[model samples]
Target chain A: MSLLNNIYNQLRISHKYVNRLFKERSCYISTSPIMRDLMEFFDDKKNWGATEVKTGRSWTKDDLRIKSNTDLHKLWYVLLKEKNMLYTMEHEHNDQVRLFPSPERLDKVLDSMENLEEVVRERNRAYYELETTEIGEQTHKTITGPFGLEIDYYETEHSIPKEVNAQWQKEQNTKCRPEDVKSFLLKYKEKEYLQNKKQQRRNFNHVIGLLNRFPKMDMEALKEQYPDVDIEKAKASRKYKPPLVFD
Target chain B: MRLTQILYTKIGEWSKKYANLPDRYIKRAMEQVYWRNPKGIQYRPNTVVKRKKFHFTLDRPWSAQFAETNSPGRLHPKVFVEPIKKWSFFRGDRVEVLVGKDKEKQGIVKYIVQERNWILVEGLNCKLTKLDRGGVKIYIQEEQPLLVTDQVALVDPSDLKSTGFEWRYTQSGEQVRVSLRTGRIIPVPASAEETRDYKAKGLYVEQPKDTSEKDLGEVTFEPTLKTFEMEIMDQMGIKEDRIPKKSYWY
Candidate 1:
């Protein structure tokens, strides 16, 4: 019993010692010889493996717009680094099967980045607009697709000229719709047309029924409601021959 | 209502007198004929004149066609762009913390938060956190804000005092930082020293070069925030719109 107890103590110490070794190595490797920029990606050493992390609000376009291009430029990097750091930490945590702290911090950084991009785009547009009397945003055009559907095609610069470039030519060759697509579109349109006709017929008959039952009904209002229905013809028809009594 | 119904029925019968017999049912017969024999054309019904369209969304909006003509794409963005041109302080530059417990304490500029306008100078401002490592508890110090850009100022290279700078044009049209008090031509930061094109922002080489070259290309100077402020109102004077829409954010 005493020997068994001694073995258990030895096993426990070894386990604790392994744990200490891991903790020591991680702490030393992560903490030692760090620079300022490294600080941007790393949470405070205390926040490492923390269950929660507190943060402030994301950057808004208006607030960002007020900042100098230089400041905005700087902020972009800080947020970017923070994002990479969070992504890495989260990935590591996920790998280790540990809970990642406040994921909203990542969201906050992303939101700020999106807003920053939007603001930068706005600035680019404004600068371009001022310099050259154009909105400077990428222009889009409506083009007829192979399926004969109108599609918006945004114009972009290509390094290879269309006529000379075999790849571009091959891609552009998708001008005519395939037979199956045409067939699919045809049947799809037929279905759509039938659905429309069904509704129209229903509306027409509904008008006749309405007129038959409501003989003293406001015909002008009824005609206004169902413009397609011929009220006088319905009245002359056999369906409208005998007015039904309202019980 | 009764009078209108009577009028409608009378008009309905009278309309047959005015029109040909076949015209009234022509549309209905056409729909039946088209339905019985499915053809190359679809949506043959009267109301279906225009074609429906499909808009294709690119699988990647930020790539393929999304790349700009001049640049490959937007900055990879994970890396912080060292503020060389726009912000006055550069990492490794000696600076004095203007605010907080570390006020007036001079230290080497370390990390900077460009957008939030925060800075962390080495050993200048420290926040204490109690941490537990395994079974051992220890105190950890986090170096963060002395607030940032406005919170600190570059220590004058001459006297090691805080100083402001203005841009001066060199003979070669390069812009250089002119220290306000001493009229010293403080070298343009290594980060800001590059030409305006692609090299404007990035990581600074760990060691700052000795104060040998300090001028910036005219193109490197970014448009100031104030240039956009009261944009319509310039040194030429404020031009009020004949009618202010008041539609813009201040």
Candidate 2:
């Protein structure tokens, strides 16, 4: 279903581009060969069975920042198609038990998509901030959950107000009892405390080991690396014996 | 801070540059995640259990050889690495060996394992290894890594002699390595820009899917007081006559 939706969207975009081509009658031409079929999901035939597919780095936020909104809209679809094609290739290779060449290509595409979205968001934010007093992004709030833990709750559009919504009010009610919530919070705090203590102990032991090995090691650098570990305490530890020197 | 976060900082920038792989890819390839917190409600959100202590060697952190050496349940002996304030050694640097049979021999740096402050100089310190394959004995000389701090010294380009260097900024505020002996600039070699993808940035071969330099550099944007969606809609000739109904956000 999603694949069919993607195909429909691609066709609409291509149709739009074709219309624009006729309207502008400019020398703008796409370099890549357009299959306009399911084959578009796969990579070029020349890239098949290749040991490595060399590609340039992702589009950085700075690079995308200079591009116009129309250009960014076109680039978004380009990236979406590339991402789909890469995914199809990866799935096909996995099915055939063949190694996917340059798996980092997927990461690069994802990084580019993220940067592009961020750039678009930045532009939108700037315009919104200048016109309105808000950045005009999604609204979220830090609220206490039933489990006594903080939750980042993103606001959703609702047809009715909160006071009039009986179902929502009932669903928002705490499922756990007061005693249960109290117990859970107590245990959670204890667990957090234990974890912090364990980390401190690990750092202390590692520092002692370092002192034992490198007797002439730079104390300042060591302290900077592990600020929590007390160098004086680690030095005084029985495990941190100084290297014997013979006169 | 998490152990993985600390380990990530240990990976040197120069070492990453040589691989030319994204940090996300490197982390994904190298990490051994035994367990992870699933989506939805949980006691500890975003908690993960994974391998922390990685044995960084000549093999890249993302390479198959590195995975094999650091396979599950394989524990290596603890190695003590001295903490340095700054990393000065880089690839394509000419350095003279201070120890072993190749002592005083000048060679270019081939590889660097910054986690251990180790660098492999071309044809400097070597170890002979005999490989027996199909009843045929073949002896090959393999370059061994030397400590950048003590086992090797940078070669002064001015007199072609081994000399200590200091990092200094020029009049233009560009930081460069300067030979202390002659006070001459030890320029970073052009070969240092070489990576797994290309030898140099300008020399990179653009793939079929890559955007062309001409298209990428073209200034298509003209500052306008419009939101991205509004501009895109205008370009697409989208008309919205109906006003959106007021909705409550919760």
- Candidate number with greatest lDDT: 2
* Candidate whose TM-score is highest: 2
Which candidate comes out best when scored by DockQ?
A: 2
- Cα RMSD over interface residues, candidate 1: 26.7
Candidate 1 per-residue lDDT over residues B1-250, each given as its tens digit: 2232222222122112112222223222222121243444233323333111111111111122322311322233221111122445555667788777888899975554443335568887788998889989999887866544356777678877888777788899988777898988777445333321223334223222111123221123346434332442554387766974433110
RMSD values, in order shown: 32.3, 7.5
Query: Given candidate 1, what's the lDDT at residue B69?
Result: 17
Q: What are the TM-scores, per candidate, against the unseen true structure?
A: 0.33, 0.87
The digit string of per-residue lDDT tens for model 2 on A1-247 reads: 9999999999999999998877575334433455356788998899999989999889998888889888998899889989999999999999999999999999999999999999989888998899998999888999888788898888888999999999999979846788998999999899989988888897788778777776767788788778788888888888887787555
Q: Candidate 2, residues B1-250: lDDT per residue as tens digits?
A: 5652485335787788878998889988988988999987775678888888888888888899999989989989877677776788888999999999998899999888888889999887889999999999999999999988678999999899999898899999999999999999999988888998789888899888789999988878888999988887788799888998888988
lDDT of 1 by residue, A1-247 (tens): 9999999999999999999998887776553245454565666677887776655345667667666565566667777777888888888788999887766567667778988888777777777677787776678877665565556666666655566668766765665547766886788789879977776666566666666544555466566656666767776767664475666
lDDT of each: 0.56, 0.86
Q: How accurate is candidate 2 locally (lDDT)?
A: 0.86
Per-prediction DockQ scores? Answer: 0.01, 0.51
